[model samples]
Target: MAMLNQIEAFQPENGASWELYVERLNFYFEANDITSADKKRAILMSVCGPSAFVMIRSLLTPRSLNEVAFEEIVSKVKEHFNSAPSKIVFRIQFHKRSQRLNESITEYVAALRNLSENSNFGNTLDDMLLDLFMIHNRCQIAGSTSNGTNLHKGLSAI
Candidate 1:
């Protein structure tokens, strides 16, 4: 099928590339209305890169494929490759993140967004708080009197 061909062509690489691959695969699935579990599993197996194929194959016993659901297989792959950071680890990195000297605000904000997504905090309020904290701590407003003002005010003064 055309969908399967598309999936096969977009094999995900290990490490940083996995996220992009997952996003693309999800988009394809949604666009094609490929909701069936068996079909999803088949597509996943078909599109898996060499490393992923080897890893998943090793995890499977004689009857594993027949028994495992599509969601479980996907979860196992994600768990192995894209494990979420712990809250402490997330907090430490978040607090430690500083805007580089030459980086634009847009670039810095993008970095923060990437970190926030990977942290999986799953709360908009927490994400807002983190954004506020990063803006307050990392951004330096030119000729700003004090740090007590809101982000908008701080940026306006710049």
Candidate 2:
């Protein structure tokens, strides 16, 4: 699927507040991947911490970590993580007061890593995927497996 272009101004005009928006967005994300709940929670806490406002900022802005943008985001995330740092407790608790923490930052790096693993959809496809994601909130791509699979056999299976 292709990503949809989302304009900041196009957000609903029914006078929505920060909390409602966050709740709705969270619901959408939760609907997308139930398996990632723990991962999502960990990521959210890691990045956003106590500030509920961060969630709003994330939704309003379309994030892209290109070669140039990647460096900047990395620097910011690293700076945030280094300040307080995550510790291993019985259960993880991302410190809210920790200065500069970014809740979804690790997820960004994980995405980059996943994209990098695809040889056919290499760096070039990486950019295309980002474009597709931004444009449709989904990926648009030709069918192929990252692991070496016989194309003929894979297609035959379908």
Candidate 3:
């Protein structure tokens, strides 16, 4: 139980995923032989940070924390913190993601991949990614113009 005090409060804005935090907490319980459900609940409430604990309290309003089981608290917190974003929201971000001027193709592709994570692109993910990359790359190439003079001059010569 003493060793379990090392568990840090989860801050989603700090880039720590809830899944990873839960995984670590479970492993800590296993290592320290803290199997008591009551203890787990107490530890979770104590270690969940002040803001989250307040939120948890609100989530259980009208219901006493003592009456609520460990699983219930964990489930409620997980639902609120780990809810998935809408697919349309993800797709909008993915579509609006244009490569920055200084960003390399590799970086741009990686950004696209990250943006596409929850996009529900399904089996066409690769196809769509390739198509966007090609289109954007072409635009980047031909998008340049010296008052349209160079392009027009070259075309006139041909």
For each candidate, what is the lDDT? 0.64, 0.35, 0.72
- Which stretches of candidate 1 lie above 4 Å from their native place? 1-24, 62-67, 78-85, 100-103, 117-139, 142-145
Cα lDDT of model 1 by residue, 86-144, tens digit:
76786667556777888877776677666666556565633454355445665546346
TM-score of 2: 0.18
Ranking by TM-score, best first?
Answer: 1, 3, 2
How would you encode candidate 3's per-residue C-alpha lDDT over 1-158 as one tens digit per residue?
A: 26844888977666456667778888978988989989988888888787767778898988988888888887887888666678998898888788798886667768888778778897777566655644666234233423333322322332
In order of lDDT, best first, we have: 3, 1, 2
lDDT per residue for candidate 2 within 58-111, as digits (tens), equals: 533565222123224334544433443223320122211111235342354354
**TM-score of each prediction:** 0.58, 0.18, 0.57
Residue pairs that clash (backbone atoms under 3 angstroms), model 2: 3-135, 3-136, 3-137, 4-135, 4-136, 4-137, 5-135, 47-102, 47-103, 48-103
Candidate 3 off by > 4 Å: 1-6, 12-20, 81-84, 95-117, 128-158
- Number of clashing pairs per prediction, in order: 0, 10, 0
Winner on TM-score (1 vs 2): 1
The candidate with the higher TM-score, 1 or 3, is: 1
